[model samples]
Target: MSAPKVLVVLTSHDKLGDTGKPTGWYLSEFAHPYDVLNSASVSLTVASPRGGLSPVDPSSIDAAKDDSISTNFINSPSTKPLFEQTLPLSDFVGNPSAIAPFAAIFFPGGHGPMFDLATDPQSQQLIREFWDAGKVVAAVCHGPAALVNVKLADGSHLLKGRKVTGFTNEEEDMVQLSKFMPFMLEDKLKEAVGPEGAFEKAPSAWGEKVVVDAEGRLITGQNPASATGVGKAILKAISS
Candidate 1:
């Protein structure tokens, strides 16, 4: 069989919070998974809601260049080509019939996701399509915030009965930026989704926590640190 095709979605936000300060994609969010998936020969595509030149966090890139995975992803001739090209969001708009091109959809997280993905109607629709298609739908950190508004055609939550985890409230609090965040993601998820609906998480910073609700083909990671774990989980789902 052909290599599994995976679509990696990212945030194109060029600014952080209300302060309008500059910001970019978190490194580990993309680098870690990009390497793991690339080595597996998965056909990968990177797209952002706003598209065009997904920004790499300055710190992440600096730190990654020294790390094994990051250095490999950057120096490898094959993966390096993606760093130069990215698909535009306009290509995904209202193309439900075209959604079948991918075997799975993965979203990497960073504060930037809170800026655009948290409420984009198109991104929500795309996610619904993935879930409906019975393909893997995975997100990490703030990437799960994008699920807050995704609903299937039947009006049920896309994640209604699925056990999933994301950046926890304690993690946010630890970052010392919880108060300034646009919304408490963990709280809103519990309130809207419910007690039995969500999964458990460990108390750790950038810990490797990933939840895969066997019934729904939905997977989630707790933070940037869970990127590789999340990628491995998605690979399992795709192969299954």
Candidate 2:
């Protein structure tokens, strides 16, 4: 049998809410999870909305000071090319055959996700397909924003009846970008999940929080600090 394949989706978006500041995928959000998955013999395909070189949030890389794993992922020769050569989302969305090989998908977040992935129609479709195929769907930080708009065959929101978490309202407040994002991620998540799907949050903004709802094909993390937990959950689901 072939190695377990995973699709690691990244955000190509830059520019944080017209502030002209650069914002893109958080390095550790992708790096930590990727390292864990890689060690598990998972092969990852990196894809982004715009393709080509996906931008890394400068602040994210800088903040990963104590995290050598993330630092190594950014600077290591083996991982450098993967980060630079992201396939376009259209490549997968335009050709179903191209997306057929993956057993699971992961979305790693930075503020950029709030700008694009949250409403990308193609992303919504891909996510629905993966869910219906009984594959694992996981995200961290602002990543869950992408799931808020996904709908299933029965015409119900994907997040409905599921328990999940993402970058909370307080986190946004702490960063002072709550007003800048296109939509409040927490509010959108709550709206999508409905009463049946409880959208809960971590008590603290930077807490390590993750939730796995097998029936919903969902795994989510509260913030960047939760990325490793999200990765472990994805690996557990895949292994199980």
Candidate 3:
């Protein structure tokens, strides 16, 4: 078999909910996973809702400039082209035959996905197709926002009966943007999964927590710290 490939979807929205301040995918949220997945010999295609130039959430890096992954993702020449030339979401639309070839699709979190991916029809269908095809679907932090609106073939929300985790309401409040977000990530996830679906959380804010469905196809990470963990989980899923 050919080497497995994973599609890493980033958010194109640049504003943090009407705050008029800029926001986008958190650098480490993508970088950590990129680093891990790359180390495992997995190829990746980076894409965004509108494509080209996935914005950097400045706050995510401003404080973590010294972090190894954050530093490399922001300044390393090796990574420059990937972020600058992101493909448009259209590249993956209307082609299940094409989408089916991917072993998995991942959404890296930031405030931005809550604005775009949650409602983007292409994103929703791409996820549904990947899930229906029995391929893996993964997301991290606010990235799980992408799955909140995805409905399975049975017309039930994909998250309706699955266990998952993401940025918690407590974490949002800790960031003091609880009111700034369009909606609480935790609350919305709980509602999407319905009463039977479970939303587990990390013991502490910014802790690393990843949730992979029993079958190993549906994966989620709790926050930025969970990136690498999620990446490893994806590898294990596809490797099986």
lDDT: which candidate is best? 3
Model 1 spans > 4 angstroms off? 63-65, 74-84
- Ranking of all candidate structures by their TM-score, best first: 3, 2, 1
Model 1 RMSD vs true structure: 2.1
lDDT tens digits, residues 1-240, model 1?
888988888887767687666666677877787767777887888888776677765656776766887767766777655644667666775676666778888888877777788788878888887777788899888888888888889998776766778888888899787866789877766665665587567665666898888553788888878889988888888877
Error of 1 at 58 (Å): 2.0
lDDT of 3 at 216: 98
- After superposing all C-alphas onto the true structure, candidate 2 shows an RMSD in angstroms of 1.3
Q: Compute each candidate's TM-score over C-alphas.
A: 0.90, 0.96, 0.96
For candidate 3, lDDT tens digit of each residue in 1-240?
887999989999999877899999888888888888888889898888898898989898886777888788778887877777899888887787778668999999989999999999999988888887899999999999999989977898898878999999999999899888888999999999888889998788888899988599999999988998998999999888
Clashing pairs in 3: none
The local distance difference test score of each candidate is 0.77, 0.88, 0.89
Model 2 over residues 1-240: C-alpha lDDT tens digits? 888889988888889988999999899999999989999999999988888888889999999988999999999988887769998888877466786898888999999888889888888888888887788999999999889899998998888878989999999999898888899888998898888878777776798999989653689999988999998988888777
Q: Count clashing residue pairs in model 3.
A: 0
